[model samples]
Target: MIVDRQGRRFRNLRISLTSACNYACTYCVPDGKRLVAAQDELSADAMIQAVAYLIEAAGIERLRITGGEPLVSPKLEALLRGVSQLGLDDISLTSNGQLLTRKLPLLLETGIRRLNISLDTLDPEAFRRIARGGDLFSVLEGLDQARAAGLKIKLNMVPLRGQNLDQVLPLLDYCLERGFELRFIELMRMGHLARAGQNFQQQFVGLPELLALIGERYEYAQADAPVDATALRYKIAGRGYFGVIANESVPFCRSCSRLRLSSTGWLHGCLSSSNRHYVGDLLDKPRHQALPALQGLLVKALGDKQELAFAGGTTIMKIIGG
Candidate 1:
């Protein structure tokens, strides 16, 4: 296993297919501030080869395909097909659900059985405002299609203080009725949101308050997640499972088993920093030579993995492929 110096084995690999996106979420890639890679992104074959080497060398079994929005990448389907053929234990995708309705069949055909959709609020106006001109109806249609496709669905919600907090209980009800897992991520002060003028303090909400509110209404118990998983999961009795990814309020750095690969093939050990090592160069080497070289860099990087600092970063969430 790819155990870091701290003894955290890295088993999950998150790869970004593209830095392009459709929705302009306020907390993520805000309006007029999208950052696409200047360097050409690795092609489907190259991505597969790189990931295959990592899977073998690092013993990474679980793979997650992310992006500014993964569906935007034309090479996504091919990439997924190639990686799935490697016999990886799990393969999942994280998307905004904008174009997912039409691509559901292709996604499943390409071997992605699990999906995480970014759906912050159930309200249409709130969605548009928060997502900066996103269509809530289209996302709903995508969700319907995903459920019909028999995919394990998880809704990733970032609860802003005054924005989606009102819809919290309603969102829970919706997820429970549909048997979908709900993950509430605390509003992180990173990238554009870290600006002094962004008023990030006003938008922040702690996980404790959310848990207390949910506990008051539902009979929920802490559910066991994988040792390396970041989210603290809970199963609300007779309803469905929910998770609180309190990265800031209750940091899960000690158990983080993820290493993110950007669209341009940059490797990031931490989510809060823009300092990424260029792993793409190793892809140019022959398979036999690349494996050992890539493994060495990964081991050195993991050895230097440090706890995250959530303030003052220019790299947007899309570029990091979170």
Candidate 2:
């Protein structure tokens, strides 16, 4: 088992299968004229093999499949099948919910038990604006499909100050009425923001304020949302449940129990920075050597995990498969 300096055991793995996405959310992958070539991505088979090795070496019991849009990958079903073959304790996916209407049946058949759909706005126009070219109705249909397939679904919303904050109550009403879990995530800094001269520090909303507002109308239960280190979960008084991911305002690094593997084959010890180790290079080496190297790297990285530093910057959530 890999233990961090704070004694948190790493038992979860999040893997990004691809960086390509169908939707261009303004906050996520804003309209950029030039596209980064896709030559750097890891092949599906290599990803599966690496995950198998990691699970064996670290005893990771939970796995989350993520992407710019995981459903955008044609081989998503096959990948899920491979993950199931690993006998993981839990398997889930984070998607944009655009293609889910057509893929939900196939996904359920492949052993995916839980899903998280990123839907930042409840208004049709607002959704189109935030997601750039997304259809709000398509996502709603996808949610219905997922529910019918018996998959536990969670709505992931990124609350921006001037953007979708107004839709908070409406989004909660929709979730509570439909009995679906909803999560409100704070915007975070990532790639290109620094170069673009944008301030990440001012882009976040305080969790206390958001929670206080919800508390006025609902009761929340604290639970875990594994992908995020700063997630505080809750269950609506008489409605359903929801979560708040306050990455910028509140850092939960001490309790972090997961590691992220990028689609390009880099292992990130922490998600806020670009610091990572290349696990792909060790693929050609013997298992004994590769496993120990991975463990040592994780141990060292965890020992060096940065404390909460709130400087403004940006990284594409899609690139990191957040």
Give TM-scores for every candidate, taking all chains together and pairing residue i with residue i.
0.93, 0.90
> lDDT (CA) for every model shown?
0.82, 0.76
Q: Residue 280 CA error for candidate 1 (Å)?
A: 1.7
> Candidate 2 residues 1-322, lDDT tens each?
7765557766888898888887777666656422232678877777888888889777788899998778888658768877789888998999888888888878888888799899988799888778876688999998987787788888888877777778887888888888788888877666655444445444556688788777777767675555535578776556667877776677776677777788888877666665677888876678888888878777755654555543433556677678
lDDT score, candidate 1, position 111: 73
10 residues in a row with least lDDT, candidate 1: 303-312
- Model 1 lDDT at residue 261: 83
Candidate 1 clashes between residue pairs 3 or more apart in a chain or in different chains:
none
Q: Model 1, range 197-272, lDDT digits (tens) per residue?
A: 5478788878888998787789888999977677889997777899998877877777777887888887776676
Q: Pick the candidate with the highest lDDT.
A: 1
The TM-score of predicted model 2 comes to: 0.90
In model 2, residue pairs whose N, Cα or C atoms come closer than 3 Å (at least 3 residues apart or on different chains), thus clashing, are 189-314, 190-314, 190-315, 191-314, 191-315, 221-234, 221-235
